[model samples]
Target: MLLGSDVRRMLPPPAMGRFGDLLAATTSDTSGLADDMSGDRDANAKLIEAFRQGVEQPI
Candidate 1:
């Protein structure tokens, strides 16, 4: 998902406060989820699952 990484790149400034924090979907490493968007169907599934799990976590 280049789109997903692009969206993260577009997160608002922290001047936006908690909403900014909520929208900032970055991993610890700046490389991002797009790096994982390779390989077969199973790989994509794994990434989607990981993203789902991350989304379910508290901001």
Candidate 2:
């Protein structure tokens, strides 16, 4: 997932614009998905720290 994110980040502006258009066309509603994934910010930070310490998997 991180690698995919990195690849998407590397897309050129025109490619990114097309990607966004495709996504918007396919997805009817993203707000609910966004809300579902919007976890605790502090917990996320702690999890990231734990991953960095090798105590947790990146996934």
Candidate 3:
């Protein structure tokens, strides 16, 4: 019972509006190919590398 309540509380907030807005923004920027995580493996690799560098050397 305690574990069940903790699991439920760990879930993200029910913000449909905010999620929709974010989805719209991502799709708009990704050119409708946002669902293809493995379709553009090279692009994905570059993106991950860029993200890693950005995190390691912020600004």
RMSD of each: 10.6, 10.5, 13.8
lDDT scores in order: 0.48, 0.46, 0.45
* Candidate 1 clashing pairs, residues 3+ apart or interchain: none
Q: Which ranges in model 2 have alpha carbons more than 4 Å from their true place?
A: 1-4, 29-59
Error of 1 at 41 (Å): 0.5
Give, for candidate 1, the lowest lDDT window spanning 10 residues: 19-28
Report how far off residue 33 is in candidate 2 (Å). Answer: 13
Q: What does the lDDT come to for candidate 2?
A: 0.46
Compared with the true structure, what per-residue lDDT tens digits does model 2 show for residues 9-43?
A: 66677886686565444332432333344697556
Per-residue alpha-carbon lDDT of candidate 3 for residues 1-59, written as tens digits (9 for 90 to 100): 34323433444556534543454455454544434676676676556444333333312
| TM-score (C-alpha, index-matched) for candidate 1 | 0.34
Superior candidate under TM-score, 1 versus 2:
2
Clashes of each: 0, 0, 0
Better of 1 and 3 by lDDT: 1
Best by TM-score: 2
Candidate 1: Cα lDDT at 25:
50
Ranking by TM-score: 2, 1, 3
